[model samples]
Target: MTDATHRRPSRLPTRLLGACLALALLLAHQPARADDALMAGVHAFLYEQAQAHGEDVVIEVRPPSARLPACEAPQPFLTHASQPVLGRVSVGVRCGAEGRQVRYLQAEVGVIGDYPVAAREIAPGTAITADLLETRRGDLSRLPRQAVLDEAEVLGQVARRPLAAGSPLQAHQVQARALVERGQKVTVEAQGPSFRVTREGEALEPGGEGERVRVRFTNRELVTATVIGDARLAVDL
Candidate 1:
């Protein structure tokens, strides 16, 4: 067990000892089963799965109030793959070989880690710099779904709205600083395997890095390209 708590011993009857011995033999002959201790299996599954995002994980699985039938060959799965797996998560368990009987369990996946927060109040349109941000450690799952953990995603970005000091930075509150402006002359590059072409064009719209911009070439032809740098855009051939 990766983690555990000690509990005082309780008296057991002589007949129960024989039953425990038989159960131990059963487990020895079979593969590890989540059904042995339902919550234990769920925690193990979540901890292992959450390891991809962070090393330190704390999980809490809530058992249903109603008694559940013993599960044979229990297989656990995430109920909402598109939704956030942290905080409150729904996990589904398939009981028996055919997986016809399904049950859902609620869980909280708390990953302890440090995330960047605003060191000072940042006004709208302010470009983020390392000096303006500080790190705070806590349960990452308790943070906003769009919280920005990677400093690279925050630095040099323009804030879309005011952020208070010590506030957790989220993805929705920031935007890439505009790299190309309307009516600006831009270098348009179209590239393909083993070939590349560069042409001069005028941007018809303002855009940030990785953003799409419409441009008109000297030939009066229009094309949409992705902004890669200041006054630079690219289109895949």
Candidate 2:
């Protein structure tokens, strides 16, 4: 009897088989979901933008419920109207092989920290004090625009409106106390490169520090001066 050898048939050629294996490996190394790639890109972009503002930002990228096709290169960018880069803002993420395919995802970015909040019901015109203000850890994205983050910013400043207890402080709700009163006598000091002059004058308008006020001098000379301190104004000569 002649010896017989059994042979197995190959489903794919050697080159084709190698290609399949390479593709499988590539997919395995990539992110399992397209949203994951998009989320990462958006997080990185927001982090870089926030860092430029001298803030240590904590960001959370909300995942999209809709499924996205697999993409090779993903890019994240801010919308044109998303100015100031604070509070609730939308970020766009584009993903595709060559920019031919693109999908945009909206993510919520927030800064994590202790922000100023009213500890008691503060009446309008009341100066903010340390005892009446407290810091609370919260998401800054949901907070109001121009929210006060530091207590020092509102301290010694008069409230523009009544604030309820536990309410967050906002920049628009506070104003610097007036340093010069209208019709009050003020010292007008003019300084130049080589000379300095001082005269007693009457203020025409109430002004805070660094604010401009019109002053009438003893000689009835009218001049605009910047309030530098209590009863003090400076004019550039």
Candidate 3:
């Protein structure tokens, strides 16, 4: 074989090897997967915010239907300034060497727990009871800001307004039920570090437990006392 014939056969293999290496390098420099980038961006944003708020929360990030362009660095942010990080919200994913490309996705965050709800229509001033309330597993972040998270919070509390059946109970919508009625006879107890004394008195206002009420003693003296229970008041001597 001549020198030209030997060179020709080796040239084909050399070209083939060079092509394979170029292809590999091209792929290696390419951006990361769109779903993975988006997910990482969103999760990091949400996780940091949740940690800052001291909330033990689970964040579920939904991938965008449209594939995002490859990016060197991805950053996620809220779509709206007032949009809360909790519940159903939209997040914007930005990618670029210095924040050039941008995209958006939807996500949900929830505090996994059982929350209280009204089992029946509750009238204003009606005291909440076990039979009138129910518990449901839900994302606490999706609920209202004042939503009651525990059954104990709503029980024994009176509704401040008309509550629809199946509606979530809120902390601001309930108050402790009145334990002492207006003009009712009550036993006023005066207690201190040294001694305790009990006397008969009349309630001048309706109040719940731990609430302040005025009482008129048999001696025609008015004293401010804290309602302790049904027809009962406690005064510090």
Candidate 4:
């Protein structure tokens, strides 16, 4: 009798085997596990390819001159395997999705591009790329264009007078300087018979001219005086 026995049929078909192999490869390429928790986070991903053919895809980035805040994620979602994360993102400016012109895009970690992306994660010192896009609207607005206005700044003093359009602003009017303190030793000069002893104890540091200054006497009494010429002082009765 012949030793060779009849061969058993293969469990999987040729096409089925090939499909199984392809599926396995795809699974391997993806993350080991998908995050199910939906926490508020940013999602900045570049399209694999550009959509419109022969169309200019321009990306406008805000330069460091303005110093904008971080780009935020649009929705609450889990992290994707391919997405770049800068860790613990928060609610930033909201960005537009799939539009020729987008306004107020929330800042994100960073964005890639199918159409030559120049997008990046916005931060304190991030340099913005000046790429103006000529669309129906103005320049493409990114997630963050300007810095975050803190509570102090938001409620800070505004221009008391109405500013006309295209008016040049002076630095002093916009910002207030530090005021002088009490008991600061100021230099006074002796002129004529009256040894112009600046009727007081000490003067405030950086004492302002024509500004009120508090003078403490040896008796611990407070007397207000006026700052006159350079280092000169006059007691205000």
Q: Looking at model 1, which ten-residue stretch has the lowest summed lDDT?
A: 27-36
| lDDT (Cα, tens digit) per residue for candidate 4, span 94-177 | 333422221232222332222222223222222222221111221222222221111132122233234333222222222222
- Clashes (N, CA, C under 3 Å) per candidate: 0, 0, 0, 15
TM-score of model 3 vs. true structure: 0.55
Q: What's model 4's overall lDDT?
A: 0.35
Compared to the true structure, candidate 4 yields what TM-score? Answer: 0.22
Off by over 4 Å in 4: 1-167, 170-181, 187-200, 204-207, 229-231
Q: Write the per-residue lDDT of candidate 1 for residues 1-237, one digit (tens) a residue.
A: 588889989978889998998989886644333333776778888888877667889888987656656776778899877665678988998888999998888999999888899999999999999999999988889899999877788899999999999999999999999999999999999888888899999999999999999999989999999999999999966
- Name the lDDT value of residue 232 in candidate 1: 94
lDDT of 2 by residue, 38-131 (tens): 6777778878876543365767677765665665677777774536466556776666655666566565566666788999899998988899
Q: In TM-score terms, which candidate is top?
A: 1
- Each model's Cα RMSD: 11.9, 8.2, 10.6, 18.1
lDDT of each: 0.87, 0.80, 0.81, 0.35
lDDT over C-alpha atoms for residue 217 of model 3 = 84
Q: Which stretches of candidate 3 lie over 4 Å from their true place?
A: 1-56, 59-109
Of 1 and 2, the candidate ranking higher by lDDT: 1
